[model samples]
Target: MKNPNGFGSVYKLSGNRKKKWVARKTISWENGKQNRKIVGYFETKNEALKALANFEYIENSKITFKQVYDLWSKKHFENIGHNRATNIKSRYKVHLSVIDNVSICDLKIKDLQKLYDNLNLSSGTANQIKSILKMIFDFAIRNEYIDKNPIDYLEVKKHKSVLERKIFTSEEIAFLWNNINLKLVDTVLIMIYTGLRIEEFLNLKIENINLEERYCIAGSKTEAGINRLVPFNHKIIPLITKRFKEKNTYFITCNNRKISYSTYRRAFIKLMEDLNLKHTIHDCRHTFATLMSNAEANPASIAKIIGHKDYKITEKIYTHKDKNELIKAVDMIN
Candidate 1:
């Protein structure tokens, strides 16, 4: 069978064998040298046609990868949650320059693999790049700009290093609470008491805290976007209530203006240095989960409080349940 464009050919291989399809595009260089390139070879005509159609579509759109990516980024900025949109824009600015000029359909998995290999980037960073590219491709496809995502076939290498899940001991927590200034102390305290992410902590509003109900309704950054109501015991209620008079906006920020992640991270690092603590801000969240598990809180309940989808996520990430509580779990095993 001949291609619709009369630029390629397809043939049946043999009995009990599939058909072979090939696509070729020829062009003359600036120096008048002719070049013929094989765009793709597929086992099925349908697959070949799909690829050809994608190529044709891209060529016809007359849109550069940069143009499409910019459009995607703008739409993404408008659609995604604020924190997520910020992260996507930051990542794209850092790693997407190389492929910005190429057409979307012409971006091969091999090209992406090579770009990833040369970047000297961490697996997590590479994965983020892949994710951003996938998002852009999804946008393109949804808008009928392309037929398939070439990025789907690319794989990111996994880093074997396990993340540190440090949980502050009760004594350490008391030491931190006593030493730090009142302004920043409650931020850490809230994270330890509620297992909320630092981002979530900064985003919390006065309305989320219901003194009458004794629970704080907060949104998590997980895929499901779970909004959990964490019960505030007598201890945490007074701490949050005291701050109610300061501002009606976020609990952590001073001016109600959104603080960047780097700003908070730097502040936490300075705080840690002053205290001579070896733990990260995330450890406060871990400490909350550990303390809860030690208090014999149910795994499912802990997961719910932390906005995790299920107990498995809580267990997988916070592997170090308090030893005494672990013993109780162990006792049940036998």
Candidate 2:
């Protein structure tokens, strides 16, 4: 069988005869410039030769950005964390997967910008997509697939508007306590006083409670959150004593059954609706922080108590001034 010396050769191995065609072309130029390399195998001899021809043709015509990016992503994200890799792949599936067939040369800055802007995702998510796109384009440039990265000029817009969270006032809190089932009131009050996230509160086990030390160790969302010792408020003690007698395995439960997220969510929603309040169960945490701030509690201490990674988050977002506190402060103007 005769094959061109410069072009790739297609051959079947002796032991694996009738196997699919295997083709290999050297990574060298036509003008006597050579490099040591073996390229690939294909389903047929024509397919192998066609790949070689395209390899030569690609010098003049560009490959798709998708083709370049897919290769790039494999190497780029190989060393990243599993959770992070999953997140990046999820974004690619939703946003970048469609444009995989578009040529790199045809992709302009505006084309990418339009794709990003159309998503209308959260600030954090939008920024993640922008960062990933730039990396993909940078990969294309480094691989000689494109001259410059169009993603360099792209800007991800921030959603400037912040959502207003509803927190309960002292009066509203008392009204809620007075209205709900006496048994459920303990769980609600624990969340309000302890500043524990609803899920964290639900996951508390019998061993996690330390009555001798007066601080129950719980919370597992972040490094700061894990095993945080939240001191029990005096009011929730009676409820604890009652539960201790019942000998339930978990801290929060219904008839010895674990209080699932859905069950708690439904109960919270029902309570809010009954009270005609516009607040989620998480607002109990906000209320605790607000009350602490009003009592002149240290911001750093508040952050630590609530399992915040940084105290600045507590100062900036959690420690808000109530209307009564604002009025009292203004009255002190002499």
Candidate 3:
């Protein structure tokens, strides 16, 4: 007897097979051809019939991986911090391209494992990808799109990192100091002397600087760093005063307006090109830390001034120290 239309079919295959009964369904059609998909196999006709009846097809609603990710990230990105959301989006855009268009319901552990194994990234980055996949799968499951997450079984391989943070050498520092009158060179000196992260420096407001006290209350990225008092080195005091007198809302400005990192980055690239220096903006912070350590600044003072929450400093020294001690530490750099 013929089965009802669109109900799929169960039939027995030719003799040598152990699971002779096959369950098949018409998943799609193209150019007058029915694209039959194999649902599963069974040892008996009744078993195949039961399996076919129980099998779920994505005929009505097809949810692709990208679709789920879009839905998940739409609400998810709003609640998380900007940096974290940017990192997640970057990983998704760069690394998860393979499964982007594939239907979420069709994904399996082998596919996920293959995707993970093919990536050659740092352990932290690779693990982040795994975590992103897991969250997407969990979203699908929550929405009744899939019964289980394939990422649960997928394993990521870790690779050793060779990347190192390079700092400005003493000679390079001298070159910068001598050329400080050049365009945007003073900003580099400010970053180096104060140990401000690139973001913190870009976001520094004029109101935060106390010219007489010679310190700026500014920070970001970590609890220890936020709204902290960072004393200015005497060498950059002239530079700071000049910038402060500009009367712009932010101390760091270009053409009488607040400057952005991208704009500053382009200018920095040109400056580096001219000076023959190979360094990133963050390296200024590294140079500051190195200089302070060489001057034998207290470890706790270093951590406190830099917004790092070192265990030893946090437990023993950072709590007891005050702004005066930090000022003493800052003065040790030069």
C-alpha local distance difference test of each model? 0.67, 0.70, 0.84
Clashes counted in candidate 3 amount to: 0
lDDT string for model 3 (212-231, tens) is: 98899987889888898898
Worst 10 residues of 2 by lDDT: 325-334
Model 1 Cα lDDT, one tens digit per residue, 1-334: 4556435443334555454676555433456755554556678877766665554323425667787888778756876787787777677777887777777767767887787666656678777788888888887777556788877887667744456778888787888668655456766776787777877787777768777756667787785335666666445666777777445566665565756776787787887777777888889878877887787766755766666666766545433444344323322210
Measure candidate 2: CA RMSD: 11.5
Cα error, residue 6 of model 2, in Å, equals 47
- By TM-score, who's the top model here? 3
User: Which has the better lDDT: candidate 2, or candidate 3?
Assistant: 3
TM-score-better candidate, 2 vs 3: 3
Candidate 3: where is the Cα deviation over 4 Å?
1-64, 78-83, 98-108, 118-122, 141-147, 156-163, 178-185, 220-226, 245-249, 253-281, 309-325
Tell me how far candidate 1 lies from the true structure as C-alpha RMSD in angstroms: 12.1
- Candidate ordering by TM-score (highest first): 3, 1, 2
Worst 10 residues of 3 by lDDT: 311-320
| Model 1 clashing residue pairs (backbone) | none
Q: Encode model 2's per-residue lDDT on 128-194: one tens digit a residue.
A: 8888888888876775667887877877677543446677888887876676464466677778877
Tell me the lDDT of candidate 2. 0.70
